[model samples]
Target: MADDRPPSGLRSLLRDDLRGESPYGAPQLAVRAALNTNENSYPVPPEVVADMLAELGETLPGLNRYPDREFTDLRSALAAYLSRGGEPIDPVQVWAGNGSNEVLLHLLQAFGGPGRRAIGFTPSYSMHAIIATTTGTAWTHGRRSTEPGRLFTLAAADVAEQLGALDPHLVFICSPNNPTGTAVGLDVIEAAYEAAPRAVVVVDEAYAEFARPGTPNALTLLAGRERLVVTRTLSKAFALAGGRLGYLAADPELVDLLRLVRMPYHLSAPSQAVARAALRHTDMMLSTVGVVKAQRDRLVAELTALGFAPVPSDANFVLFGGLADAARTWQALLDAGVLVRDVGIPHYLRVTAGTPEETTAFLDALAALGPEHHLGTEKAS
Candidate 1:
């Protein structure tokens, strides 16, 4: 018997704003060379795996009770790890959640809500808007530089002008931004902070470890700025996406506010234990950063040689244009056993910088597509 449920039942019951919204995610497809999600192609180091198993043995016995709500040890470990580049951070100034998304959600919950507004440059991580709207914060889609030959770079002046006009309560800046992997300069970050004196300026540095040398971290700016927050994730560089730990460094006072918004025991016992062990083996876990960066640069060169307008990247992915039809190219790649992200940009797709062999597979797939994939007169030169 067919059930006669109303077609729009859930939609009617859902919040009016969320009714037509699609959940944000990439295609979790199974393919030989999967580069769609910007995940590190390398698996966790065996040594780290053994260490995490040992730590889990101790933590498993206490699963009956709640895990440390504060995640004290994990915070301390993160603080120590982040201090490597001469920026000493205290455990008190750290916060963590299941992933950076939750951490961003906490920020929106604490600082953004009804009657408040947050602004993000366009073509950034889409979650910035999704998280803000879910928290009842109005979101402003600020513009990035669309100048001729520029790919998604944001200028400090543009940020300042937007902040002055919108007067938003929260500002999100993604360094080594998603889809278009270009890292913003520290000047842009500083400009955003100065433009909105009352706003919580968040720098989502989820791909910080993959950044080339001399790229300034926003954590360096937390010294005198109470409202500046820089969020990081172990998912990409540390190969701990499965462990699901993301954290931030900020002023201690600002860190305290996130507690009010996060749920109790948000970090589970196993999750905490695994992440702590991974941090302990940080050197081993991050052994792939150099390799990934090398591959990223290789992607830029190869894509450019193939006549695609590959954006310069500081992250583990490359966003390349010059395709006649990005969706068709995406399907063609998938058919050839490679996968990449379309990112909704016409004539463009973002592909993760995978292992050398995987990168070759992706490039070869595109090369195989030949001039048929080229937009205008540009061909592999």
Candidate 2:
């Protein structure tokens, strides 16, 4: 019997792009050394947690009501934290969402749609491509330069050339980029902006706090640029991955445009309360930056000695390029009650720096695997 459903009347664009898409959940959690998500291993300070709980208890009276339509207080706090000297922010120049991922989506919604293109480099955070595809924006990837025996690096000239050719609507660059964990140079960002004067240039600095000494932040470049937007998250350096707080700093005019498209009461009161408490303890959060850096250097050294090709990472997680069998290595680590990310790229694995004990356990696990299982390719020069 033929099923008698009416002919679909949806737009071809929707049918073509999102016909079979499904929601995704976080990675599995097991009682192992979890180093996949780049989350801090430390717990929130007791005092901070107590303060947040107290604040939430006070706000219980309004729990039944909708949160503030505009998260003004939270935004003010975040703006102050981000400002160089705690100067006043226009407030109109601030925007918040569930996470920086959502902020990136809103930026795409503002600038990308049919016929317009969004551009990013290859092997970036996967979400950029996912969001662009779901939004019906044309997505393009620019190739990074790699001379024989050299590491992968983006060339500003090459980016300029590609931008000139594509004339995209939005350009995305992730500094201390995910998976690869390398920081993009200020010159490269400036050149990208120069190439696309009319396009919105988004610098996703989700890992900016982990950036090494002397690395330029995108915020320094946002003062005079009308089309530039910088997205940041509290998840990484602030140890607020569960708090779901993310924001964008942009030209006041641009931020106002985002408000028009953003859903009202987007941030819940509990989230706001916790984020504020975390912000008040900014010194403690900043202190983790140095600790993570030291751990990162140590992890790189240990991994290098074990004959793994760990990339020069400025972020909390590091990537290795010479895994003999990434899938097997990942499974072995998991079986031994240690878990790292298997990126599925040929011979590549990613490991987030964990606590001192977790780090030692990971090294011991690798050591048990012996040199025969080790992938000791020459380091990229």
Candidate 3:
């Protein structure tokens, strides 16, 4: 074998701050049931698949040419989709990237750099800090309520106070936040915006479609706020995760600034075609939302009945507590061929609301462990 030592080794070639850092990703194991990663449990409807095939076939021969640098048609489709919320948005206000993660990266590249700082209310999406730091922007770990049962709660005054003190260049507000599955109210969004006069306030609504009936989307608050941005994805609700289309809506001028950072024709023609085709069948693609929401409710109810404290979730996953040993429980579930997320929170694990069959598999596996995985104080009644 060739010598595989230092100099050419990754550690030696990596940046100083990135030397010991690990990339963010959930485990991709071959399991009977995978309730981790919060993917839509349903497959794309066959009709939508047929449409995507047709679009791809028509666009394939043109692959030799570069995709539209602006992805104008995709932007218009996204704009139309958002219009259903009763807030009409112009196509110019939309920006997209390979995924919502890449859209976030573009934001950091455009608005944040070495001298600037970005702040996020934690136990939120971990990627917020990761994206900020990777872009050379200082990352500030802001606090959320940590009272016994209020781990994911964020108050407007608390967020405003943090913003005023940290005065960061970017603020991430993950409504229907990941890991915890808790959503922040518009009051918190407004408070952060008013507190940080110069910061770009990002409201990540990746799971907005799964929110309870009355839950409002941050898109409603975008009328006149030039600094406010709401990022969403087709990955979660549209069953298009593999297509990797994530987009945001902001002021036309603000969205345009992202173009400065994005590589020319960053989105492939296939991606654009596939996303547009899926958008045409939005109703069918979203037919499972009600089913998913019902399953999510079932998870909350059943887990509560089992003596686990499942956080009230507006997203498609549930973050539960009362584990005697979270790591042990996580491994036991894996051993049983059921996988959930170990989100680094003590005594807690997050599981996605999948099909009834998958949900049953996860619940059955956890129940089979009996009292071994439960805290003595959390014994089921």
How does each model score on lDDT?
Answer: 0.92, 0.83, 0.93
- Model 2 per-residue lDDT tens digits across residues 132-221: 887789999877766644465788999999999999999999898887888889898999999998899999989888888888888878
lDDT of 3 by residue, 1-381 (tens): 996555556668787667668999989888989899999989999999999999999999999999998899999999999999899989999999999999999999999999999999889899999988899999998999988767788999999999999988999999999888898889999999999999999999999999998987899899889999999999999988899999999999998888899988999999999999999999999999999999999999999988899999999999999998899899999999999999999899999999999999999899888686897744552
State in Å the error of residue 9, model 1: 2.0
lDDT of 1 by residue, 1-381 (tens): 996664475666888788668998888878999999888999998888899999999999989999998999999999999999799999999999999999999999999999999999889999999999899999999999888766599989989999999888999999989879889999999999999999999999999999888988888899999999999999999987877889999999999988898998999999999999999998899899999999999999999998889998999999999988899899999999999998998889999999999999999999999577889844442
What residue runs in model 3 are displaced by over 4 Å at the alpha carbon?
1-10, 377-381
Q: Tell me the lDDT of candidate 1.
A: 0.92
**For every model shown, what is its TM-score relative to the native structure?**
0.96, 0.91, 0.96
How do all the candidates rank in terms of lDDT, highest first?
Answer: 3, 1, 2
How many residue pairs of model 2 clash at the backbone? 0
Off by over 4 Å in 1: 1-7, 377-381
**Which residue pairs in candidate 1 collide?**
176-183
Better of 1 and 2 by TM-score: 1
Candidate 2 wrong stretches, greater than 4 Å: 1-14, 19-26, 85-90, 148-150, 376-381
